[model samples]
Target: MMKILLIVFNWVGKGTYWRALKFAEHLCRRGREVTLLATSQHNRIGIEERIINQVRLVETPDLFTGSLRSGWDMWNVCNRIAWLRNHDFDIVHVFEARPVALFPALYMQRIKHISLVMDWADWFGKGGSVEERPNPIIRNILRPVETFFEEHFRTWADGTTVICTTLQQKATELGVPPNTIVMLPNGCDTERFEVIPHQIARRRLHFPHDMLIIGYMGSIFQHDAELMACAFDIICQQIADVRLLVIGYCPIDIRQLVKKPQYVIQTGFIEDEYLNNHLASCDVCWLPFKNTNANKGRWPLKLNDYMAVGRPTIATAVGDVVSLFETEPIGLLAEDNPMSFAEKSMQLLHDSTLRLEMGTHARHVAETRFSWADLTRRLEDLYQYILKTGTK
Candidate 1:
């Protein structure tokens, strides 16, 4: 049996961690021995090690978590390299391309001849929109490292998995063979995110029974809250009983920006059990991404979750969202502005039949195309191919 090691740079809370776990679980079920190693920010916390759903998960303290002073990063990289030597892995699947992520895999390649697979989920250079760029000092320091990772990592990697076509294009431009790259888009855990009756869900969450709820769930990054506020205001003027459900943390206070603060409900980052209930309780879901280079490459996990719960989404045509909503009528797409977004959302809110139809289509798409079960099979096939054909 092939032994695979999945390496993540962060804790179990993030998107990468979930993706790694799903892959490991599926791979283990297929008779491959899979182990996932993740790092946490907490200091002096006991090592988090467990066998969850047949996948082995081991967590350790993040080497450079507290301080970024001189030599700490290198020390962490060396420690990680040393730790990696203890395991006998046929493949090292890295989720990021940072120095810490790369050095250990490079060491394993040289010493143990284990193959390496790198997954690129974002553009990772210059960071977000032009306005969102880091300060000059930070920019100057990060520019070279980001550039090196973007340009040369694929050339050295044995195999690559990309989240979107933009990253695939970037990989091809960097001279990575198309055959070596697998298009592993983000997916939903359909079993967990399945539909619950809206009335029951709303009752459990203490939301109004008659109101039309518009939900925006998950972490809010590069999402224009001001624009969403304006859109919701327009939605309110058109519809009599409209409510906005904002779940998770946002940089901007969406409640303060919107006109009807009373109509908005903020359920600050709840547990996963409550997430599906919140998603199913909504009449419509919103994905308001600012149309920027950084957003263009992202595949929002919330979009998949929304679809999995059988709710129609009104999303800005950014990133993989354009391809997702454009090809199929599962959801409505609009420009990344207040007026355009508001118009599409109002159309969905007013038309109950249309919303139901779109919701059905969205669920079908989620089950057929974006289920983790299907996606993991693809991942397993890719791993098999990589193992069969020696490292490139």
Candidate 2:
């Protein structure tokens, strides 16, 4: 069995954690030995221990403090390089676009390395411009330094993988060979989200039997909360049985909007099992992302989770979301407007046939196409290719 070493900034509660976990699990199941090397904390101990036989935790000092000085970041880079030089592995997999972590791994190229660019961070400065990114104070101070480090790392890696086509194009523009870069879209773990009886789930959550629950589960930003509140108000006016179930953190100011009796149910920061319970109960799941630079390149992880249980979703047409759901006959896509969002959501709530059909299709897609097993196969193939070619 071939040995693999996966490296990332830190592994906690995020998209990266899920991606790494899925990949490691798939590799281990195939009789390959996998070792995950992360900066600190191992919060998903249960998942990792189940899959990977070895996990190495490296200690690195916090670089982002008050001021944007270069010293701290530079110190962290040196420390990471020291750690990498001491470790021996057959293949190294690095995630993140930051040069601080990339540079050290690139310098220690005794073993083959694969760099997976999850998102293009440099695009944040340009206001989505391709020719030149905006010269913000932070970018102006950091871009040149990061570029120098990235250039070396890009050239050093044995192979590279990008999450989306747009990201692959960006990497090509940045001088990475088109052949070296591979496309591996984010995916969901379908087994974890098996469908439960809606009525049973509602009973478990203590939600009313007859009400239509429009649920959302994630960090509710202020703008998102306001938009959802506005949409809910419109839906309530049109349909009396409609109720909102928000299962994540919402700011104090926004929480006030849901205070109207029998209108909204707020379960802030629920555990995963409870969140899944809420997901099973909901009539529909929401992916209300604002059309901003922050969201354009985003591939919301929740969409897969929502679909895993055969739940139809309503989302704003932002980033690669349009493409992700365009083929999804199971969900509805709307413009990033409250009126449009409300109209689309109501369409799903009012028609049980449409909901059932879409939900069935969604579950089929989740099981066949978006399963973690399939996603990890793609990742494993890329790892083997990198090992064979000795380039990323």
Candidate 3:
């Protein structure tokens, strides 16, 4: 049996968390032994260990509690290294290039002679996510640091898995071989994610049945939120009965951004138990991403979330989203401007038959094309090849 170690920088709740956890679960069923290492709390010094659905999850302590990003805690890195010393695995796949994940994975490869593979989910370097920082000081400080960490170590890994074509291109430009790189986008929860009845979902939440609802999954960046606010403002003028449904912890202040705060329903931070109901309540979902490097280099996880709930999306035609929209009639794509986005939203709102047809197609696409089974199989193939030739 092949024993694999999967390392992610943070614990549960984020997109990266789900990615690593799902891969671990799927790979386990494929007859591979998988252990996931992550950072749970900042205050604790010792490790907290548990088994989640046959996969072992070992949580290390992160020293810095105040910082929003994980993997900066040196104490966490040392703990991970110490923990890894006792266990032996055929392959170690580190999810991100942060200090906590990258340094320890590198140690196991260099010192222990274990095969190492790195997964690049986001572009976090010189021309990538560093530019997404709103503060100029933060951007300037992270520019070289992010570049050094994201670029300097990727080439040395045995193999690389990227989430999008944008990052695949970036990895190749950074000197990684084409053969060693695998591009796997986000997948849907076809088996586990339940689709609740739309009317019942709205009634359970006490949302009015008469109003036309437009949902935007939360956790947006400042600039993306700016584009969303602009599009939403234009939407409100033409359609007076429209409501904006926000389903999670949004950094953007919807109340202050719009003309009608009453129409905005923010659900704050919600647990996974109520996720399906909240998603099913919306008539249409929106992905108001601007045409920027940050938006272009990354694939939005919420797009799949919307698809899972059988909701048609009004997404901006940016990044790899262009291909997904052009290939499938799952949803309509809007231009970068607010006027175009509002127009697309109105187009869907006026026609319920079109929305239903597009939404059903979206769900079909999710179940067949972007399922986790196919993704894990491809990843398993990569693991087999890496173990055979070491991607040299």
Superposed by TM-score, candidate 1 places the C-alpha of residue 372 at a distance from the truth, in angstroms, of 1.8
Give me the runs in candidate 3 sitting further than 4 Å from their true place. Answer: 66-69
Root-mean-square deviation of candidate 3: 1.2
Identify the candidate with maximal lDDT. 3
List, residue by residue over 1-392, the lDDT tens digit for candidate 2: 77676655543434365666566667777877776544433221111222233433343554454223212355566666666665666666766545544655556554424333332322322433221223467557655655454344464455676665556666787788777776666677776677876899999988889989988876544566667777778888899887888776554344476535468787776777776778889999898877765466445667778888889999988777788689778789988888999999999999888988888888898887777677778777767776676554
Which ranges in model 1 have alpha carbons more than 4 Å from their true place?
44-47, 63-79, 127-141
Q: What's model 2's lDDT at 155?
A: 47
For candidate 1, the TM-score is 0.92
Best of the candidates, TM-score: 3
The pairs that clash in candidate 3 are none
**All candidates' lDDT scores?**
0.79, 0.66, 0.87
Prediction 2 TM-score vs. true: 0.80
Residue pair clashes in candidate 2: 126-134, 157-392, 158-391, 158-392, 159-391, 159-392, 160-392
Question: Which stretches of candidate 2 lie above 4 Å from their native place?
Answer: 39-83, 99-104, 110-156, 220-223, 249-253, 256-262
Cα lDDT tens digits for candidate 1, 268-297: 868877888888899999988888777776
Worst 10 residues of 1 by lDDT: 63-72
Residue 166, candidate 3: Cα error in Å is 0.8
TM per prediction: 0.92, 0.80, 0.97
All-Cα superposition RMSD per candidate: 2.7, 5.1, 1.2
